[model samples]
Target: MNTLVTGRRLARELGEWRSTGPAYRALADRIRVLLMDGRLASGTRIPAERELSGALGLSRTTVAAAYSKLRDDGYLASVRGSGSTLVLPGLERGDHAPGSGLPLDFTKAVTLAYPGVAAAYAAAIEQLPAYLAHDGFDMVGMPDLREAIAQSYRNRGLPTSAEQIMVTTGAQHALNLVTRSLYSPGERVLVEQPTYPHALDTFASVGARMLSFPVSQDGGWDLSEAQLQLRRAAPSMAFLMPDFHNPTGTSMTIPEREFLTAAATREGTVLIADETTALLDIDRGALPPLACFSPGVITLGSLGKIAWGGLRIGWIRASRDVLARILRNRPAQDLGTPLLEQLAATSLVRELPVLAASRSRDLKLRRDMLVQLLGEQLPEWDVAVPDGGLSLWINTGTMSTSALALAARSEGLGLVPGPRFGLDGAFERFLRLPFGHDVEQLRDAVKVLGRISSRVGPDPLRMPLQAVI
Candidate 1:
């Protein structure tokens, strides 16, 4: 019998292991993990049906079903005798996955640890069996976890209640659910230019019209332009990261927050305040959340940045009315976030002091290293040292980041171009470099990037920044 070695061979080389099981589920899960981990390069040819099924000890019919699902998910390509192959692009495991042996992965923004987490998780798991007798489908979330989240917000000066909280798969799912519930097709939404790149894609999928305002590295958002867009567009919803905004790391000023929220209130614009990165406040004495200023804001908070991305639990704090509407909309997307993860997050949340301490040390160390490295090696590049967060937004001014990324990729390095975060490719002159990796890994990536940057053409910011005001 043909080992069907070629398909299993190539796939296994990329870490797609085959499994023998009563159900094809084990094999299916293996395929999903490979894709999610990015081992399955998008557009790669897959193995033949007969080959894979036989090699993996699964029924041909089972293999066919698995392949069909993968195909539906854009993870595999189908052909005749050539068979299917792993082919999926970027995917999230909900929380941060610790770095494996990949050469370089500066694309993700995650730190090493928020310490004391293991202990908390262990305790939570130990406590989990006590409740395992009941079904763990916590769509609304656990009361204890909800209380912890609400308490955290209250500690930060935002009035929160367990009644207002709803746990989710992640901030991504939370955003999707909020958009679906509150906004309509053809309704307008506003985001920062060069915002969280993936969010634009997610929001766009729901047919939300997008308007972006420029926010500078010095951290000034175009208030006038934003107000104009809100008034003219009368957007039904808006997503703001008032704290440690993505890409540029711009935080909204108290004045800006007050003015914007007042206008949004007048126009009845529902604000999606993504506080996901806000907890990463290295400033120690950072201002209160924008949600504190506006009752209309539906704040989204997650454990991914502060604790671990793998925790896969985020919550939204909204009015009772909005909560009811969101609850109604929940069934279409997901049945509920897994009860186990909720338990994990709850355990983590209660242990914030220990987690926050470790995260602070970890992020501060990485940030310092990146700043020193960038200053010493890539001085020509305009890089901002953000107050908090796992990444750096470096201005390669007027350079083609796409070309730079391609060159780096060829050198066994991975990077996402700035335009990936911009609509109509606005930030082609910039790039977001995550220092959220092992120090050794980050240093290596910077070295490779230094080489790539050197080979590239002259930078447009060659002219001195006339005023760093």
Candidate 2:
């Protein structure tokens, strides 16, 4: 079924859309920005021109011109009776399209493979022969791998057993499995305002009605608002990243975690915590896992950031009952986690602390270097240096980050706009710049951005938001 965005809703999402352009162009640009930001899903039926014009208190001619501009830009397709439908160029909805052959892609916050990954793979191949005697379709995961994952939790001060674990291909796959198993269509789901973009895609893919509270750079998680929403909306599930949060790079305090856990318990909301970036700590030290405060919390962990992106190993630490529920629905999504990957993961888990130390050292150097470069090159921008996490969340101050992104694209730099990280087109001025690249690459990207910033106006060229890898 095609999703429809009513005129009133679209107007609400427009959120002070005016920019330095003609009314029609500004309107069209805002719509295009919204589409690229994932605020407007591809294949969604847009409101009719007249309906939108009335809703925004604009003339029909202006709305018609805006629609015409959007159609010309390949963002909308018009049908006679049915209204215009949003479309991304050269691809359909749910398709995984690569970046625009750009030399530097800042859309992903991942680094290259860890140095120990190759040896781990070799170890996995050696261990694989022993497992070949039995059928390789592993739905629940191997006992050894599960135990390793459980031990990781135990080391973190959270007591987890093997039965409470379910391994998947990656953190993304784990999130998908958990969301599909736990959430029903049309159910309310709460999330951080600026979260992992792909996580937003996950919730949206499930037809979830999302509610959000702000995750500010200075204020951190808005506990008061979250509590109010939990009590008022009573959402079924709340997805969160309490440690080294994506985009924001801020973690919640222990008191905040306990408060949220208590509130969610009272509201019957299950907290699904993504700890994919939990161990990416640089100097902030460890905070207790969100699950430590509540048994109902479901935590997702991954080796993508710490070990290697290509390794493709992640697991869910939930109750035994929740693991069973996920297992029952697993086959429809995938046959099982790969045997070789699990074996490699097992080896990597044991080497985590060493890998983490190495990773932290490298990350600290790159992060500090990137921060210095950005600060020197772009002094006007408000760049926050996070203690840990993959990226620096920047407030572009006077410069529209979306515009900066568009301008940077001409210089062969790919970036995810701020709105892509949040719901309903928020965070337009913010940008997530990952320092997971070589210092040279980081320097070049920042120099390009600084150069482009001066040339591009506030109304940057609107482009599609790439599916985060």
Candidate 3:
């Protein structure tokens, strides 16, 4: 179904609207920024010029001029009687708005394949002959791979058994399976304010109503508020990324984990912890996995970050009952995990610690380099140096990151803007910059960002909204 932004809603999203340029240009630019940031999703219907003008207390002429600017810029289309519809430039061509087959892609936080990945594949092929006698199709996962995954959890101070694991093609595949199996239509799902974008996509696809709490780079999780929401909303489930928590890169403290676990158990809310980036550690020492705090917590683990994303193997660690429920629903989406991928994942799991150490050393170097480049080039922007995780969550003070992202596209750069991580048009001034690229690529990205930052200028509504002078 297509989204239609009402006049009142768009007016609220537009905020203060005024900028250094002409009013019409500013209005059009803001709309373009919103579209770029994913706050105003593609294919959404824009209000008629006269209706928007009336809503914002502007003349129809000004609104018409704004619409004309957007149309000329390839951001809007109008029909005689059907009204205007929003269009993202590259998306109309069936490509991503940014990084659609682009050479320099920063939209993904993953890095190049690990050095040992090739060896694992070779070993998997050698081990393949033993399973040739049986039918290749398997749904629950191969026995060896499940045992390896379970042992990994045991190493992490959490007890596990092979019966508690179910392998999937990737972490995303696992998340989708879990969401579909557990959530009912219109049920409330709790999430962080600026969580992973694709996770938000999965939740929305299920028609789940979302409630959020803030997770700041400095302050970490707002546990008090999270507890309040748990008590008040009584959501069906709470999706969390507790370890190096996605864009923010802040892991939950041990006490915070225990506190949250207790709260969830009391409220009867199921907590799903995404540990995809859990092993991507730099200087942050080990923290207890959220599942260790409570048996009810369902954990998602993946080798995508620690090894190679192309390996495409992940698992869900849940109680036997939940695992059984997930297995029953699994075939509706996929027949089974690939035999070749499972063999490779088993081989990789045995060497997990060695691979993780190698990845950590490489990530630390890249993180330091990226931080230095951003500090020297774009000093005005507030950047948090995350101890773990692959990205930096930047606070672009007084500047609209959505505008910066739009401008970067002209330079052949791809960026996922801040609002992509939040709901209801929040995080417009924030951006996630991944440090998983090569040093040279990071340098080039910083240069492009520095150039674009100056052109993007300050956000008009940086301060509280008040009566215009």
Best by lDDT: 3
Candidate 1 clashing pairs, residues 3+ apart or interchain: 45-85, 46-84, 46-85, 47-83, 47-84, 48-83, 95-309, 95-310, 96-309, 96-310
Q: List RMSD in Å for every model shown.
A: 12.0, 4.0, 3.2
| Total clashes in model 2, counting residue pairs 3 or more apart in sequence or in different chains | 0
User: What is the lDDT, from 0 to 100, of the residue 184 in candidate 2?
Assistant: 90
Tens-place lDDT digits, model 2, residues 1-469: 6899999989877755666668898788777767765667778999887899999999999999999999998989988987789987766444323234578878789887889999999989998889889989899889999998899889989998999999899999999999999999778999998889788889888889889887877888898999999999999999999999998889999888999999999999999999999999999998899999999999999999999999889999999989889988988899998999999899899878888888899999999999999889888888888989999998875556655665676688888777678766677777899998878889889989878877865444333332121
Per-residue C-alpha lDDT of model 3 across residues 290-359, encoded as one tens digit per residue: 9999999999999898989998899899998998889889889999888988898898998888888898
Task: Name the weakest run of 10 consecutive residues (lDDT summed) in model 1.
Answer: 13-22
User: Considering lDDT, where higher is better, how would the candidates rank from best to worst?
Assistant: 3, 2, 1
The better-scoring model by TM-score among 1 and 3 is: 3
The top-ranked prediction according to TM-score is: 3
In model 2, where is the ten-residue run with the lowest total lDDT? 460-469
Q: Which lDDT tens digits does candidate 1 get at residues 339-360?
A: 7777778878887766766776
Residue 218, candidate 2: C-alpha displacement in angstroms:
1.7
By summed lDDT, the worst window of 10 consecutive residues in model 3 runs over: 460-469
lDDT of 1 at 73: 68
The residue ranges of model 1 lying beyond 4 angstroms of the native Cα positions read: 1-102, 459-469
